[model samples]
Target: MNDKREVFYAKIMLFGEYSVICDSMGLTIPYAHFKGELSFINEDKYTDLEFAYESNRQLKKYSLYLQKLIDDGELIFEFDLSSFKKDIDKGLYFESSIPQGFGIGSSGALCAALYNEYGQNKIPNSRHISKKEILNLKKIFAQLESYFHGVSSGIDPLNCYLKHPIIIQGKADLSTVGIPRNKHDEKGAIFLINTGHAGMTEPLVKLFFEQCKQHSFYKSIRDEMIPFNNNCIKSLIKGETKEFFKNLRGLSKFLLKNMEPMIPETFKEIWNIGLDTSTYYLKLCGSGGGGFLLGFTEDLEKAKFELKKHNVELIPVYKNAKVIDTIKNI
Candidate 1:
């Protein structure tokens, strides 16, 4: 029972939200600030036995779900169910800081940790991993994570498992990519604006799929959003700051108009403020029912000043030089 795995971090989809469904390029990065791990509670030092008990109960339920999948031969990979059951009986639970339903890959981290610790014939994270292997891993994760999202692209868990930036060129093409380096003294930043509520990815994604059935909606996405999203990915990857911001603004505007249902009602005014003043631009962080809204600005201080009236937390994607250095090393 000593086979503990490293913590799995949450991931951010920097570009391509629903557009990815239509074969648009998407970029995702591992956000190490929020993470999760599998561990057992020490009942001796713990006062809250109820919390531990509940967590263990939840794990038992999840174990049953996995067992059902295995029994039905619906899962492609094998899991050490005996060991997993033993751990669950010993009160093993996923200890996580990543907020569930916050659009930050909480379920993805759990899936990654589970596969890493319990899956047999696991795929190792390395540069040498073939594209075929990566796609297989993604498929495995997509099936496992469907328990949470109803449907999944599997990119989130794949990114968490690899702990590397991933570029999804289309439905069938994905690869690890190095993010362009950030300047130390740069004032520009990408940030998350808390919406103060958790969002259900299933419903939002379902809504998106339904909307896509409409010819006009599908055309707008294919003609407008996909291009903007792809351009943003290309510009960001190339470190073309001016072009990146330009495409980002266009994407921001397009989302505000077409993706209105995804935006929280409370943040609508502030979202418009960014477009009206050009101080900052906002986009959906993930499925975006009510979780975090992603923001980009050339001047962090100025964006903060403009957003002061909104009672929301502003979390800079990269807060300091140390973070940049750490990412570079990764």
Candidate 2:
């Protein structure tokens, strides 16, 4: 059954969280630091027997779900489910480092691996994939990922599958984008602050949709959050640092005030501190009930100093020596 497949990496939604649902511009990039691949374990050679057993069990469950989708004619794509089941019987499972319940695309990476290995008439990865093809692929991924998120936008899997930076312009418009090159001596950085807890995206998103039922809440999102979010994406892509920071500050403030529930209670004070001092800005990475909180700071060292007592790890998305060296060449 050949269960081995190329690894699919996790993704970070750099901008546009809830706003993307309403057709605002969103930017996402593949985070190769964490990834997953489908593999079969030989019980004699595997050390973690319980983990292997559990993973195989989960994959069997997922296969059943896929079979149901196939039977109902709900899934538009074709895959060799018979072979997939054969592999599952052989202890096939996803081996991944991507943490679940984080804003990062854990399930999305799994869906991508499945589709990459099994999908019929698969969309080839290329710079030339058409808008229509991309949208169609997104729909397929959305349905596939629904097993995890309850509701799926499919953008996560799309980004993971393509392994490229994606800019979502609207509900159906997405394109590959090249991020602006970092300066060799850049002081600013993007980072993730671990909340030390996982978040369930379905509940958080459900709460958001329920809140949107209110006129004022819906209007505020339309009038303030969407505009700020869209502007931030635009400014960032254009490498307009001043404009980007200005819009980021506004977006950060809006989220702090309006999306309070999404932010972790323990981290709320730090989130506010960032806004109050202009030292840093914190925003929702994803559904944000308790996963990783994304941060932006003009000075990474200053942010670290301010956040040191919090006991949370700060993982820099940029500003690493290797990244700086790559930027220098670029």
Leading candidate by TM-score: 1
Per-residue CA lDDT of candidate 2, range 153-224, in tens?
999999889887888998878988776665323878888998989998998899989998999999999999
Tell me how many residue pairs clash in candidate 1.
Answer: 0
Worst 10 residues of 2 by lDDT: 321-330
- Those runs of model 1 whose alpha carbons end farther than 4 Å from true positions after fitting are 43-51, 183-185, 319-324
Look at candidate 1 and tell me the lDDT of residue 64: 89
Alpha-carbon deviation at 283 in model 1, angstroms: 0.9
Q: How accurate is candidate 1 locally (lDDT)?
A: 0.85
RMSD of each: 2.0, 2.4
How much lDDT does each candidate structure score?
A: 0.85, 0.84
Measure candidate 1: CA RMSD: 2.0
- Highest-scoring model, lDDT: 1
C-alpha TM-scores of all predictions: 0.94, 0.94
